[model samples]
Target chain A: MHVRGLVDGQEFLVKHANGLANGVSELQHLFPAGSNVEDSDALPVIWEKPEEFAAAIDKAVAATQKFVAAAESGDKEAISSAFREVGGSCRGCHDTFRVPQD
Target chain B: MIASGARRLAIAAGLLLQGAAGAADDDLIAQGKYLIHAGGCITCHTEDADDAVPLAGGYALQSPFGTFYAPNITPDKETGIGNWSDEDFLRAFYEGTNPEGDAYFPAFPYTAYSGVRQDELLAMKAYLFSLEPVRKEIPEHDLPAFMSSRLAARAWQLSYFEPARFEPDTTNSSAWNRGAYLVRHLGHCGECHTPRGTLGALLREKELTGNPEGADGESIPNITGDRKDGIGKWSLSDIEYFLDIGMLPDGDFTGGSMSDVIEDNTSHLTPEDRMAIATYLKSLLPAD
Candidate 1:
């Protein structure tokens, strides 16, 4: 949830990269059962197309991995590009898989 | 030598004409594509599935009146509008009449579409015709008994709808006029953003102030210049960036309907057009 906050402000890019690198693996397992809460915005496609959903998660993980390496390099240009990739990965998944919010 | 020269001239003229025709077709299709983005047709036409066929049309739009299923707009011959003539298409957008001369529910936003130029509508049709045809037959609308009749739509049109083209204000800048055209005609932003009267007529006086009961019963935010209630805090760049990527100035990506709009419509617009829209939004009077 705080991924947006961390990735958005360049000041927090380093912190976001660290958090994503450390937390993405755990995030992958968070939706193990495909169970949805009453107020959850997770779309049915997540459960229906498990393979595709898993692939999307893998993309996020891969993007985050790249982002972490870029952040560690301490290069603003590289970090920015990596951060954008990570954001793209997240947005790509959310566009079709997530339930729309009100 | 004279005969050869004459033949060469003929060949050159033919090639020139062919090239000019090709360029014109390309321009028409490109313009159509842009107008489609502005119209946000995909948002309602395509289902919410990740792999949903674009423009295949099975999205169920829940309105207070009823559930209206968007019909397939792809070039499929049987179930879609593939066989619709240019006049058929024009009539639908200009007069809210279907190919069969039946009245269309206002959910199609033809009221705003009526303001679009004839050439622009034709370009839109050209773009739609260019799409891969999908044969999807959407279910008919499920409406309340009182609102189910096509007559109801026709009556509504008589009461509130006006078939008119967008007229530019000579006093405004070209950018402002462009913005007005996009927002008021092609974009039809007011259809959702503006509050409606009891009979679903748009409250023009409160344009862009926001709608409490907007599409899908969601409360749309005020986009006017009100500091507390609207996007007054956002800069022009902020608006442009948000439209492009759905990212707020506060660093949060938007969710819900606006997100879909950003992804499908505004995101595809050129920077100049987005700036034009921003200019128009900024000029609006703040309303509650």
Candidate 2:
């Protein structure tokens, strides 16, 4: 993040974080029943805090919906406007709960 | 058993506290650096293409109006802002008035900068200070006949100078504010999107209406949420993804100025900040 320019770092980090979050959420859904889940190194997010997990997904989805609507409209201003909101929701969730790599 | 649990809780709380403090500073500094790139400070500065001297300005901004020279912003006491007080920096930004007490040209983008937050500006200063200083001097701007005086910049500012800070729309979420800060101040989107007056100043009221007769003759597109030419088809995630990797939702990478923008500025910002800009831009009522 420090070495790369602002836009590159932002784009890379946000996308990677979103990908990680998606992967984690998918794993949460695929967890086997009574398969020593408590002993796992996972953050215990979706299973433990279902409401918050749902809320995060909801926010991200809503932001994405807004963005898609803007983009579909083909309005330059609209797309420019909604795009950042989508990126923000991704970062907001990541910063709050996800641990950064060392 | 309760004591052991309490000890674990205390340790976890301490770690969180440490992370929070360190993260905020890091986040702010990171944001400032990104803003500088979005602002495109380097393209006009650094003469050496090989060496990455972020803001030791030496690049030539050629135009029909004149050939403007970017100044060194490295933290050198004699040539750069190494000795500039915070007040000096703020005055230069907020008023388009430089350390020499003279009004700067709109090319400096102080008009947009006026909307920037003080803390963020300070962070940019911190980041600049942290860079390696390159002692290089740029020649003064060479204007054509009948437009030679620097005083003309003062006249332009007097007509267009409306210095103000960014006030977040209270109804909007914090995410929106983050976006507004990046777009309006740091990104200075209007520098290109907004049309310039006959005197080479931005037409503030008609911002982002498109500039077909722009300086480079390349039309700067209208981005005012307009359905026709605006980016209405993008998802927030699409926008974020595009800004991050310069790849459109349709899998196309942006080239030209936007590519440079993605590389320099938008790509470095935090996801939240980038989204904030996207959100704020999306909220704009469509123009045409």
Candidate 3:
């Protein structure tokens, strides 16, 4: 499918990106820590660098908000740019905090 | 005084010739700039710092061998390749050697660059020479005892390297040929994507299959045409758009070293070129 498809179907993306905040607030950090989750690619850096992780989560949330605003405005150019930033924010966190996928 | 007709014609001819020459030089330099980007020089040459100057090499490359710092390629006479003559420049790319005729470490990716045409290499050099010279001294590579000397690098080159020019397949489409040239030669995507041999040489037979032990402890994703194993699911436009903006078809952006590559190299490419790359990639065999 085309990137147009991605732009048109922004709900899943918006939800996925914005949900990072929920991860930051409750689900991301555990009280005991160092416990293994089955089938998880969660890297230790996520827990180790809580401050940086929170900041990354915040950036992603902000970018996703901008993306939602851009989508609502119906300006294709603005939407595309905001969508890219949203993607970049996701990447910014994934590259450092998450596990490197195969 | 009115000039004679022949003299006036001569002067006019001279001006025309000079103008033509200047335009040619401009085109050459412009082509060089584009080629340099295609060659993926900036990402490696520029240091990983906020204040890092472009092409004033201090970029640290972490490989299985060691941490290899990219040297200054800026036109600083003593610290850079400013003093390299045209022949020296060509040798660097074509022969994978330095101006002094010493073999360079394969970390430079001259193996792929060896396939670049001589004129294109010169064009890349012309563009580099036009840049503002930065006299930055690069730190030496941190290597183990076995990897210490130029001799070791020379030995590796002797074993695995072959200086060759890219020969186009006449049967292929122009777009395919262009894509091949960019992917295999200038872009050198296979250097990281293609899995390596025990000796650290690229496994040419399995190009774009993705490497498990890539630089900086990352597993490079396979871009072959496999539906399950590779990028067969990605449409040509999706690939092109991803190259342009680093966004995947699923709306996720890559956050790996591929991010820097997209920012510095592929995004700057023409849309046509990116599509051509997609075309070539689409043609690759699926992993078994």
Q: Find the candidate with the highest TM-score and give its number.
A: 3
Clash-forming residue pairs, model 3: none
Q: lDDT tens digits, residues B106-222, model 2?
A: 778888889887877888876777677777777888887665676888887777788968887888888887777667787888877777777777776776676655543445667
Local distance difference test, each candidate: 0.83, 0.67, 0.83
Model 2 residue B188 lDDT score: 83
Q: Top model by DockQ, which number?
A: 3
**Model 2 C-alpha lDDT per residue in residues A10-87, reported as the tens digit of each score:** 444445445544553454354343443554433455456667756766786776666556545545556555655555
Error of 1 at B204 (Å): 1.8
Question: Judged by DockQ relative to the true structure, which candidate is superior, 2 or 3?
Answer: 3
TM-score list, all predictions: 0.82, 0.64, 0.85
TM-scores of chain B alone in all candidate structures, in the order given: 0.94, 0.82, 0.95
Residue A95, model 3: Cα distance from true site in angstroms? 2.3
lDDT of 1 by residue, B1-288 (tens): 999999999999999999999899999999999889888898899987779998999999987778999999999999999999999999999999998888988899998889999988899999999899998989989999988889998889889888868889999899889998889888899888888898788898999888888878677888988978888888887787678767677765666688778878998899899999998888887778
Q: What DockQ does each listed candidate score?
A: 0.24, 0.02, 0.52
True lDDT of residue A71, candidate 2: 46
Off by over 4 Å in 1: A1-61, A64-102, B1-12
